[model samples]
Target: MMLETGKIRENHKAALPYYYRMVIEVPEHFQALPGQFLQIQIESKTTDPLLRRPFSIAGLSRNRVTVFYQVKGKGTILLSRLQAGDSISLLGPLGKPYPAVPGPKIILAGGLGAAGLLFLAKNLSLGSQNKKSVVLLGCKTKEDLFLLDNFQDLGIPTYCATEDGSFGFKGLATSLLTQKIKKIPGKGTLYACGPNPMLAMAGKIAAKHGWSAYFSMETMMACGIGLCRGCAVATINGYRLACVDGPVFPAEEIIWGKLPPHPPLSPKGRGLK
Candidate 1:
């Protein structure tokens, strides 16, 4: 489904102001994963944010592609007014990504889930060039911090939570992932994406210890690819298709409040068909 058909080469706002970011390009083998997402087409087809928004894919160069919005309503305030070359219309490197293993890892983001964890923390700090690899961001204040200095300039190792605690671990970055899940390294691995009560408290603390998590569901999409169905993500072995099977699953296959209800879609609505 990769069509990025790009244009808009720059657009910004972050450090809050309802968050925003653009930088499109598309074409050049267009490869973007890490909790994949894309599905623009801001308006037209009789306007009014007309269906097609789903962003996240927040950093990638060479041919570009970076869309990270959160202006929330009126289709992201009509996509923060759009600019730079304009054009726009994408589909995506779509769903299913985020799966890289090594040693120490943990990237849990909240609040526009740090724009799909800024290209998944720059692809795990450029494939473990090692900097102690860690990134846990949460926001409720402190300018709703975005990109924490671009994942600390790729050396990763970032942590910030705020709920009036004003900054760095005031509370709930899953409570510093319960003190760094007892010092990580159960072969470390727990990638999250945020909201849905912080992926249900990081899937209840990575299912009480047996780690290896990965949950990037922000749902509520509109054809980010998979012919729409308006973003549905219910697991328990019945419904799965968050923009094509997943916006990244496996936080123990998520079935948290006993989910159920999804199936049958056609007009790009019902949650990523």
Candidate 2:
């Protein structure tokens, strides 16, 4: 809950067309974890866009923080224009992170949603000798996919799916999950982050097989803190603020049917390709 000025070390278009990767040099005291996000002030001198934009943390190092985001609206379009050495305002490391779970784990990501899971995958790869972890990514087409090499470089098994049959699996990433879930030996954990529909479907699949699952929910937010109840998410226990309560919640707690319709992506939204 601190407002800090971080310098953009690197900001450029990523492998995916409309997506960009940004590396910020933060204060040495700054700390963040996977599943948490930062609220970035897109413009420093004007109030045209007004509110800050939220982006999940993709990577973290001693003095750096990285984020991957798509150019969806005016705010993101402005973000993509930022260059290295630009000073940016950040409010963050906010929201709860995914709980540490041992044993076999399956990570499901769709489109830009993969951005949030990259840090988690890195953590899982450490001392991963006995743990069986895999990443299933979905996107619209071959060109929509990014960060495959980063995941593969970690020595974690990674799979991809594209709706156009231009890549790994020919179908939704959820379909691939259905097939992979069958191969789990005992109880395993499912971690997912994607468009609302994809997450809803992944939750259902996890429940059907009696697997423990957690999901990172996405929504619009005016304030990155709990003061503004603008990011409320419907849960079995009533309403919860996505900013503080979670961007991550256990699968069984969410009331999927109550979630708003998934917003259509300009080109494509988060999910496996």
Candidate 3:
């Protein structure tokens, strides 16, 4: 991992409510791939929130990187205050990236979890040729969705699900996946990143259908590197650090029952309802 200073090219509210997007212009030496993340040092002069916050790379170009986040706590509140021309510390391109697989592909995203898959989708679209790929997104309502156009613009078929029936499908994204997967003529790969319950369900569906799958696990971290050992994920092989070993792992390897339950959503907001 490299420690680099990048200037805020743009930091503003996204088209969706309760969400924000930030773009950074980094030096030539900095590089990253989809599924890797950055540890951003929040500029709080007092150090009240001492640790850096982890954000998945949403989009990346020659020298520009984008991250999407929700303001849910003190650290994020500070992050939202940053503006254009601000300089920020970034330690990243950390963690393993999703593996490239051939054949038909299916991407499943839940709420803000969509942030981590955009880059992967972009790469997939470039060499898609005869391959069939699709994206299924889930949220509480239509208003809770964002980046649907970004995916659609790539010509990848995109579908959405909302709990309240405000959008595409009237149920959960996993339900949408179930319906779509059955229609595929042959076996394909599954890639998912979302709330634990959503991911667990996706894993189950993939296993039932005998499709290969990978998942990006979200967890708490004090240090982005493996030194702290704070972001352990329970797996069939025992606990693995989400930072070094993966934020992404083979779906069959994870022990879903051993994972900690996602915290209850607060009145303010939390990922997908």
Q: Best by lDDT, which number?
A: 2
Over 1-273, each residue of candidate 3 has an lDDT whose tens digit, in order, gives 998899999988885455889999999878888899999999836676789999999888989999998877878878888889989999998999999887898999998889999888988988843259999989888876877888888889999999999989999999999999999878889998989999999999998988999999988889989999999999999999999999999999999898986665442643422
Q: Candidate 3, which ten residues in sequence have the lowest lDDT sum?
A: 264-273
Clashes of each: 11, 13, 0
lDDT of 1 by residue, 153-181 (tens): 88777888898888787977898887887
Better of 2 and 3 by lDDT: 2
| lDDT values, one for every candidate | 0.74, 0.89, 0.88
- Could you estimate the TM-score for every candidate? 0.33, 0.95, 0.95
lDDT of 3: 0.88
User: Per-residue CA lDDT of candidate 2, range 1-273, in tens?
Assistant: 679999999998887578789999999999888899999999999997999989999999899999998888888888888899999999998999999887789999998889989999988887653259889999889887877887788888899999999999999999999999999787788999999999999999999998899999888899889887999999999999999999999989999899986687784553323
Cα lDDT of candidate 1 equals 0.74
Query: RMSD to native for every prediction?
Result: 16.3, 3.2, 2.5
Ten residues in sequence with the least summed lDDT for candidate 2: 264-273
- Give me the overall lDDT of model 2: 0.89
